[model samples]
Target: MAKYIDLQTFTDARGNLTVVEKILPFDIKRVFYIYGVDETERGHHRHKKTVQAAIALNGSCRIMNHAGEGLPLEEFTLDKPSKCLIIDPEDFHWMDNFTKDCILMVFASEYYDKDDYIFEPYKQI
Candidate 1:
């Protein structure tokens, strides 16, 4: 099952800290960022082996998920630095319509591999 984990962010006069680390729940093997995104939608893809923790470091956006079967499509809003949406490998996920200046960060359980992704609106094999 997909679960939402609210990360811990410490704020002070210096700055705010929202750290992503490897722990029991997630062993962070890779990290990536998605930027230069317009107000339009993008990233309608799903991974076959990678599990990810998606965070909104700046601005806001939404994440939609649909499991392999006729699972109900669920939507989650990313607004705060302390919130994250954890996705399992079997779930189809996408990030859409980000705010103009949004910076999306992802913590993954595996390194980048071209074969790991399946672009969305695609036939399920």
Candidate 2:
């Protein structure tokens, strides 16, 4: 199942600082970011073993996810740097409706492996 996680943020006189330290269930092995996206949507598959935590570092985007096993489709908006979305292995997700300055940072549990990806989206039940 995919869920939202609130990252710890410290606001002082200077500015605000958010941290992604011990809150994740798995240690991150891969990190990536998405930006300069066009009108098209991104991410149409799910990983077999990789779990991901996605954070919007700059702007905002909408994530539509469908977890298997007769679960209903779910939607999430990542509009804040302190908000993280944990994508489990069984969750099929796609991102769209991104703002111009959106910078989505993703932390994965495993390194890039083409064979680990399942490219099929779930059919609506």
Candidate 3:
């Protein structure tokens, strides 16, 4: 099942830290982030093999995801920097309702590949 993770955060007089390691599952490969996205619906697709952890580094955004196969669609409001939503390969996800200053950081298990995209119809990309 898809779920949210409260990543470990270290705090001190200096500031704070959110750590992610390979111990979670997949190794870090591709890292990206979205900011000032004008598209109301940023994604309407799923990865064929890549897994991801999306963190709301600043502001907030609402994400809707589906596991397909008669499963209920899930909604998540990512508003915390120390929190993340683990997205599995077959889950279709979309982004909407982003605050003006929202910065979404995403860590991927693999590099970007067009063939790995499964946009709809549950078909392969």
lDDT of each: 0.78, 0.96, 0.86
* Clash statistics: count for each candidate: 0, 0, 0
Span of 10 residues, lowest total lDDT, candidate 1: 18-27
lDDT of 3 by residue, 3-122 (tens): 898888999999999887543567889999999976488888888899988999999999888887777788999998998899899889999989989999998999999999988834
Question: Which candidate gets the maximum TM-score versus the true structure?
Answer: 2
TM-score of each: 0.83, 0.98, 0.90
**Tens digit of lDDT per residue, candidate 2, span 71-100?**
799999999999999999989999999999
Question: How far out, in Å, is residue 27 in model 3?
Answer: 0.3
- The candidate scoring highest on lDDT is 2
Task: Provide the global lDDT of candidate 1 against the true structure.
Answer: 0.78
Which model is ahead, 1 or 2, in terms of TM-score? Answer: 2
Q: For model 1, how does the per-residue alpha-carbon lDDT over 40-110 read when each residue is reduced to its tens digit?
A: 67667788898988888888888887776656777889888788888888777778878877888988889
Error of 2 at 123 (Å): 1.9
Return the lDDT, model 3, position 95: 90
Q: Which residue pairs clash in candidate 3?
A: none
